[model samples]
Target chain A: MILINGQPENRIPVSDRGLQYGDGLFETLAFRNGELELLEQHIMRLQRGCKRINLSFQHVDSLRAELAMLCAQTAEDSVIKIILTRGSGGRGYKAPLENEAIRIISSHSMPEYPEANQSGVTVRLCEQRLGLNPTLAGLKHLNRLEQVLARSEWDDRTISEGLMLNINENLIEGTMSNLFIVKNQQLLTPALTQAGIAGIMRSKVMEIADSMSIACHEKALTVNDLLDADEVFLTNSIIKLWPVKTLLHNDTNTHWQHGALTQQIQNALKDLAH
Target chain B: MILINGQPENRIPVSDRGLQYGDGLFETLAFRNGELELLEQHIMRLQRGCKRINLSFQHVDSLRAELAMLCAQTAEDSVIKIILTRGSGGRGYKAPLENEAIRIISSHSMPEYPEANQSGVTVRLCEQRLGLNPTLAGLKHLNRLEQVLARSEWDDRTISEGLMLNINENLIEGTMSNLFIVKNQQLLTPALTQAGIAGIMRSKVMEIADSMSIACHEKALTVNDLLDADEVFLTNSIIKLWPVKTLLHNDTNTHWQHGALTQQIQNALKDLAH
Candidate 1:
């Protein structure tokens, strides 16, 4: 069974560009407590990401409604994915000259966070560095081969996640999540102005940091910065916040355990589930 | 009408990781006068690409038949695309512990290359450089937001394409097509061991050059090589060969122009297309 546009259906034109060039945006949000985890934030990111790609924003509200309806069906915790593509035509990169309705695809699946949250994951730095494209950075658009490749780097059950850097060898985010490092009690993440997605979870953490008076800054972070930091952790809507028990800095055999700050942030993020 | 194992279908499951994580491989081929243009070469590249991503090859034969059927449906000349995504369910990047099926999606559309072929195109070198991930570099995997941003750089109809480079400053390929530079008398393209797709059109050009006893070398390319080149051109199956009338070298006032070598390679590539 499928829910396409608030109705049960099974057909979308094969020419939809999302199926073509992945010319679209997607939000993989958590659905719990009978509500979308961050519906508005996902919508805003979808809108912002659409503008970044020059895709028309028509029918977005209807699509959002469709997503809400689909998520409402499960009644239990699930991972809801919302995909909005330029809806098929106008040849390659050109958005259809006429206004094209964005195709909406909302799917639900059992959430996979409880296990990771129970036992902090062993994270490693991936060799595949995210490119510093300030323009396309921060939005979780459809182009995800890099994440797939980075995630494919290891199948070892022990390694939970991988960190990615930009071309300048600056630590960025993970294959799927955003990265945060605490150095001298200051919260820092690699500036998304160059690369990396400004994930909703990362944004939430920044807001929380401000509320608590923690100095949070977005700046360039290198392997050295992360290696020498007081603490390191990763965040995504699904993962919430994960304290890194291990880090594979590109240079040496040096590794560190989850620091006090990682614990603090992880605790704060966990409370949001309640 | 459609064909997947010779049956019409559209759905590939909501949990299909390819749709979820862009975890799949794809090929866009031109079908002219009833022939699956570059059939063997395209399939070989797809096979090599699939292997790199670790997707199963079991359904490849039936998938090939499906493509042939899809292409046959296009009585008139058209562009054909076949996407082979690792079908469904896996937690994060780890491939599902259980065996997985491959989802094959094929679609057809008319070629959109007339304007580009008639009047040569002006291209801007995109600020969004392609990420250099050796693991996913040469494969035409689903993660393609980089190209989307590069292609979105221009809205003017006259500017046909954009040139992309790796973060290390090595010239990669056009947002959609592979690039070729003719300097003095040799043919050159940036090697794709680290970035860019090894386009079937590129392979054909190399064959044509060898047959004509023209030296075609794949090596590292830089802005300096392009700025000093005698002729510059871009190629893909759709736009057979497009000469670079002018190229925007970043934000600089510098531009590349049409040249003799560009014309020769254009004609040479056209000859091989028949």
Candidate 2:
């Protein structure tokens, strides 16, 4: 069931700027064990996304309560999506004077995670490169044509995910996840100065590194660095963290076995969520 | 009034991927004398946009009939916006199953062409830059956060448009329109190899240039080229073409009188539309 203004309704106006200009933001999370996992982080990111797009970040509590009620009704492991748009903006780029209310939607089923999570999942380099825009960087806004294009590069379900590089050939992140590498025990991630949605799992992973006395840095990395890394893993709120077993570049493959620290970080997220 | 599936309905399903992952395409056209200006070109672009996004262009009859009716119902001059979305995919990036009917939304309103088309509009340089993604470039897809951010940079209605540069500091296009420049009787527009939308009016002007014996070339242009241009103008279907009288670049001013060729092209669009 869909929740509109804290009530169950399946209809959103076609004139929604979200559907028009992609003038909106969204949050997808793992609603498991009767709780909205990482609820605070999701709301924070949603607020920042709204601010980035010049939407008013208001009445978040009303939406948050609705999310709890929706999750309360679910029966099994599920993926819950929360979309907050500028509602129905006028027929132009200029935002409407009166914004539409936030839309809160919940679903009750999620696809099974790859069995190779322990053995490391396979990944490919995407042909579609992302553009650098620091202003919109780090916010999980709804203008996701780049990710959709990147994800559609191939239909191979075998490939766990795809790595996207920016126009400058700098490795950004996976289609829907952040990329992290371990080199000589120094955890390194690509900087978000250019593009890529800085994932919430990424933020938590960085924090875990800080607390666990692990060396972590958010710096720009190229395809070469990732090729030479001792270990690589992808992170997102939905998946938490999954190791990469192989890299598929230009249809060729390179091996990356699941490393020891991969499980440690997954446990780290589970600890925080529970 | 709104048209969804040839009937009046304000509500679209919440699961529409156009609102989910921006899995959609759109076209905006000018209406004059009850005819859609460059209607075929608009449809061709929409078709191309759907192809790039892997959306099977469907329901052409209903969308076309509704658009025609809306345009006909309007006064002598109007604006038409047609939206085609991937029709309610479940909350994920995956393309929905085949046989999902296309959702077409058409809206109409009076054109916003300013009274002082000859006086030229003041243009400002937007701080936000366009991201380069050739896969989605030139197609008027729904992923438009950059344009929304750039348009948000200014609230002054007097500023006719905002100029957007790419991350590499190359001038791409305006927030909502394609850009054109004239230097030494030579017309140059940015080649949409990486970023920016290939607008219908911009394409029409190129045709008018070819017919009018004006030298028009699409190539990579930088901010320096714009600063040194003999004339500058922004093109979109509703506005046709608007010359720039003054440019506010990083708070500095550069003025150029409206050139004869710019006016000639604008006049051509007006004559062709009416």
Candidate 3:
């Protein structure tokens, strides 16, 4: 089902800035057993994105209500996507002074992954590099050609995800998830001060680590650091966590055991989900 | 009037990747006195952009026919915009194997600029900076949040445009146009190898300079380079060329005469338009 500005429609005007210049923000959420997971965190992130882009999105309560309404009708686990655009009709890049935000909420069946993926999945390094823009860092905006190009680098069904690095050669994130590495029993994730998205599931994992007294840090990470790590994992709202069993970099095939910390975090996340 | 894939419609599917991830490219063109200006140049640039992004735009002939049809019905000078998107229905960032391109062609009334703007216009330095990524540079793709943010920095009607620099503080281009500096009777425009859109008019200006035997080079430019220039101007498809009379930067204003070379190029462009 799709709701465009509270209406049952599947079409938007051709002039929408979201379509014209990708002037919008989006959130991918999980709905499990008729409940939206991480609803508040998703809303908080969306709100921050709107503020960063100066898009006036004034439908928070109504959007929440609509999500609840949609979830109640779904019988299976689903993925909900919400798109908020700086509404239509502007001369060019300069936005309309009096603007109303356009909200699109849609739901789709959750992707069915192989059962083995839960244990561990293979990941590859993408050739496409992300551009460094601090102003847009950490915001899940609609301008995502970099991710799309990176994701297009491979079509191997066995490789679950592709990781991307910024132009500076620092490992930043996966095409659809945040990356984390465990080294000497310490958790480290790339700081998104220059690029990459600050995913909701990534934040949740960090919080869970803090509660368990695990040392977690956000800093610049390199391929060398990732290759030397004790364990590695990827996270997103849909796929909560996927342990990296093997990494394909250039012609290399480094392997890991999916270690103790990854298992602990996975179990903690599952417990919270229930 | 508007046309979506040869149909006279103003709405597109909400699932369009153009809106979802900005997986698209667009071109802004000018139609004057029932004739399209630089039609081939615009189409060539769009084709190049489509190739770079791997979007199979297989409707060049039909697109030309539609633009000619749209221009035939217009009785006044107009601006035409064409947007080609990588159709719909993709899972996450990975594109669908079999895809069709979505084309949107629309016509708008020409913007009314002050007559004095032809003589010279004021420009300001934008605080927003563009990110550097060679993979996406020079292609007029749909990821334009950086330009949108830069244009939003000022609302002064008198300021004709804003100049943007990349993260490295290298002067790249104007918010809505390409920039060129004249020094020692030579022409210099910032190289778009690392960032900035390679505007169609920028290419035309370079060609015009070459025909006139004026030395022209594309190189990294700084604010000091701009201020030290003998003359400065901006170019785009809509506003053919506007000599920079005043440059507002960091609480100081630098002034310039329209310069003889600028007038000579303007006359040459006018002759070609006729």
Candidate 4:
């Protein structure tokens, strides 16, 4: 079901900034048993995006309530998406002085993924590079053409995700999820100060690591850093966590045994969601 | 009138990848006397964008024919806009294997611009720096949050436009148009190899300069270069050209007495549109 600003509709004005200029932010969270997971973090990120882009987000509290009402109607597992655009604007690029942001809230049944995805998944390195933009580095703004292009690079059912790196050859993230690797008993993820979205699941994993007294680090990781790691995994609000069993890069392959740390983090993440 | 895939409608599916991920390209051209100005150039740029993003543009001829028909319906002055999106896809970043691009064509009355704009206009330097992405550079794709943000930086009725620079501190272009400056009888515009759109009007300006025996150069320009120029101007498909009479940067100001070269080029461009 799709609700465009609390009204059931499947159409948005053609002049919407979301369509005109990709001027918007979006959140995709998992909803199960009448509860939305990590909704607070998502809302916080959305508000942060609005602040960064100079858009007003004063109605966030009321928006949360509307989302809750929508989730209350669903009893099974589902994925909920929220798209907040700068609304319709004039033909020029200048934003309207008096603006009403458009909020598109929708829900869909979760896709059935193979159990193999949980055990482990294979990933390929993408040729497309993430542009360096510190201003838009972490927020989940709607200018996601880079991600869409990276994800389009591979379609093998056996290859679950594509790993993307910034133009400087530093590891950034997966096309759809954040990445973390285990090296010398320390968890390391690429710093998103230049590009890539800082996923909510990534933050939760770090939080869980902190509570469990495990070491987690966010640094400028390189391809060699990833290849030398003992274990690798991906995270997103929807997928939760997926241990990467093999990574194919530069026509060569590297394999991992899926270390104990990945399992521990996975179990912790699952526990927190419930 | 607004037409989505040949049907009159002002709404598009909310699930459209254009609105969701900005996986699309758009063109805005002026229509007067039953003909689209620079229609061929617009189509070429759109086709080039499709190729750069791995999209198919085999239907270009048909799309052009439809646009011509739409333009014919308007005997008076109007503005025509064509939007081509990668159609709706599943909830992931991965594009659908079999793609069906969506085309939205629309027309509106010409906006009334002050007669002073034709003579010359003032501009301000925007604090929002455009992200450097060579992969997506020069293509008029839909991921325009940077432009939107830059344009939002100012709203003074006196300032006709805002100048934007790339991450490297090099003057890229105006928020809504390509930029050019006349220094020592030579026209210089920023090289779009790193960032900025290769606007159709920019190409026409260069063409006009060539036929008029004027030297036009595309280089990596700096603020110092702009400040030292004898004349400055901006170009886009819609506005054609607007001479920059004054530029405000770093609390200081640089003024130019709209040079004769600007008028010559502007007159040449106007003649070509006929």
Candidate 5:
């Protein structure tokens, strides 16, 4: 089901800047049982994204109300996506002075992944490098061609996710999730000061680690660092946590056993999800 | 007027990847005196963009026919925009296996600019820097939030355009056009190998300069190079060529006269337009 601006509709004007220039922001939340997971965090990220791009989005309260109404009507585990755009405009890159924001909220059935994926999944390194822009980094804005292109690099159903590096060859993130590596019982994730989405689940995991008295740091990582890690994992809203059992790069496979730290983090994340 | 998939409609499904992830490409062409300016060149660029992004777009011939029909029915000067998207998809980054492309073609009235702009216009240096990614550079794809953000840096009516640089501080292009500078009777434009759009008019100007026995080269440029140049100009299809009379940077105004080389190129472009 879809609600465009609180109305039951599935179509938007072609002139919308979201469709024209990808000038918008979006948030995807998991709806499990009768509750929406991390709804506040998702809304906060969306609000920050709007501010970063200077989009005049003033539909927060109404959007939340709509999401709640939609979730109440949905009984199964689902995915909720919210999109806010600068609305329709005439032909030009210059945004209209007085513009109203467009809000699109939709629900979808939860993806059914193999139960084994939670225990371990194989991943690959993508050839498509992300562009480094500090101004737009860490914001889940609508400009996602880099991720789309990276995700298109492979079709092997066995490989679950593709990790992406920036043009400078520094590991940034996975196509649809955040990357984390454990070394010497310490947790480290790539610093998204240049590229990559600051995933909602990524932050929650870090917070969980902190509450558990685990040391977690954000730093610039590389393929070699990932290969040498004691353990590896990926996180996103839908896929709460997937331990990377194997990394396929240049016809070479680097393997890692789902270590104790990864297991502990997964258990903590699972507790938070419920 | 608008035609979506050869039908008269202006709305697209909310599930379109174009709106979701900007998984698309577009071209903007000028229509003048019952003719589409550089229609073939625009189509060629669109095709190249489709190939670069690996989008399966097989509507080139039919798109041309539709453009011809639309142009034939309209009798006034206007602007034409063509957008090709990966169409609608389920909630995810992975593209649909058998994706059908969506084509949207629309026409708008010609923008009314001041006659004085042709002589020369003022420009400003934008604080927003573009990201460096050679894979996605030079193609006029739908992922243009960087450009949109750069354009939003200022709202000064007197400033005709804002120039942007990459994260490394190399001058790339204007918000909506390509940049060229002249020094010692030689023409130089920034190479779009890393960033910036490869504008059609920029190519035409370089070709005309080559035929006219003028020296033109593509190289990495800097703001100092632009400030020291004897002549500087911006180019795009709609605004054929706008010589820069003044550059506003950090409250310091560097001025230039509309030099002979810029005039020659402008005259050549005018001839081609008619």
Candidate 6:
């Protein structure tokens, strides 16, 4: 099902700035058993994104009401996507002085991943490096061509995700998820000050780790550092966590066995879900 | 007027990857007196963009036929825009194994610029810097949030355009046009290896210079070099040439009296248009 500005429609004007210039922001969230998981966090991030891009978002209360109603109507697990565009405009990049925002909310069935993904998945490094822009970093805005291009780099079903590096050759993130590596019983994830989206699940996982008294660090990471880690995993709104078993680069590959830390984090995530 | 896949429609499916991830490319061209100016160059650049990003463009002949018909129907000057998207798909970054491309073509009336713009226009330096990515650079892809953001930086009516620099602080291009500076009777534009779109008009100006026996260079340029130049101008498909009368940067304003070279080039462009 889809809704354009609270009405049932699956089409937007071609002149929409979202379609024309990718001038928009979006959030994907999961709902389970008549409740949205991490809805507040998603809303907070969306509001932050709107503020960063200077897009006025004044209908937050009504938007929440619509989302809650949509969640209540869903009978099973589903993923809900919310898109806010700068609305339709005449030609050129200069926006209209009085442009109204467009809101699109849609729902989709939950994806069924292979059982192996729950245990551990294989991954590879992508050749396309993300462009570094501090102004746009850490926000889940609609300008995501780099991720789309990186995801299209491979079609092998065995490989689950591809890791992306920044222009400076520092590890940034996965195509659709945030990356975390465990070394010497410490958790470290790449700092997204220059590039990459800061996933909501990543923050939740860090909170879980804190409750368990685990040390977590957000710092610059390199491919070699990721390869040398004892354990690795990925996180996103849909797939809360996925242990990574192999890392492939060109003709060479590095293998790893799922460690205690990975199992413990998975257990904590599951327990928190209930 | 608008056409989607040769059919008249102004709306596209919300599921389009172009709206979702900006997985697309676009071109804006001008048509005058029942003829599309630089149509072949636009087609060439569109093809190059699709090839660079691995989007199959098999219907180039048919696309040309449609464009010619659209241009022939125009009674006066007009601006036509062509967009190619990866089509609609299920949720996620992974494109469907077999994706059908979507083509959107639209037309609008030509904009009326002030007579002063022909003599010279004033511009300001934008504080926002472009991100560096070689793979995506030089291609007029749909990931244009940076341009939109830079354009929104100011709302001054007198400033025709804003100049942007890359992360390395080297001058790249204007928000909607390419930049060229003249020094010692020689022309130099920024090298776009690291960032910036390689504008078709920029290439044409260089060709015009070559025919007129003028020196043209594509090299790294700085803001100081731009302010110190004897003359500067901006170019795009529309607004063939606009001389730089004044450049505003911080507290330092550089004023220039329109030079002979600018007039010579403008006359050359007008003659070629005939």
lDDT for each candidate structure: 0.74, 0.81, 0.91, 0.88, 0.90, 0.88
lDDT tens string, model 6, A157-200?
A: 89999999998999999999999999999999999999999999
| Model 2 lDDT per residue over B24-131, tens place | 888887777767788888888887777777777676666678887666566667667778877865336666556344656565667565889556889899988887
Off by over 4 Å in 5: none
Candidate 1 lDDT tens digits, A1-274:
3566556765555556675567777887887677677678878888888777777877777886777677667777877777776676665755565555455565556655546544356778887766555556777877676676677777765677788877678888888888888898889998887667789999989988988888999988787887787777788887788777676445444555667777777677765542
Interface RMSD of each: 3.0, 1.5, 0.6, 0.6, 0.7, 0.7
Model 6 C-alpha lDDT versus the unseen true structure? 0.88
The TM-score obtained for chain B of candidate 5 when compared with the true chain B: 0.97
| Positional deviation of residue B55's Cα in model 1 after best superposition, in angstroms | 1.7
Candidate 6 stretches with Cα past 4 Å from truth are A271-274, B271-274
Candidate number achieving the greatest lDDT relative to the actual structure: 3
True interface contacts retained by model 3: 0.90
> Per-residue alpha-carbon lDDT of model 4 for A62-170, expressed as tens digits?
7887787778887788999999999997557888876766889988889777888998999999999999888889989899999999988877888998999999999
CAPRI grade, predicted model 2: medium
Sliding window of 10 residues with minimal summed lDDT for model 2 chain A: A99-108
lDDT of 5 at B127: 92
| Stronger candidate by TM-score (3 vs 4) | 3
Candidate 3: residue B27 Cα off by (Å): 0.3
Candidate 6: Cα lDDT at A262 = 84
| Residue-level error in angstroms, candidate 1, position B28 | 2.3
**iRMSD of prediction 3:** 0.6
Give every collision pair in model 2: A131-B132
Model 5 TM-score on a 0 to 1 scale: 0.98
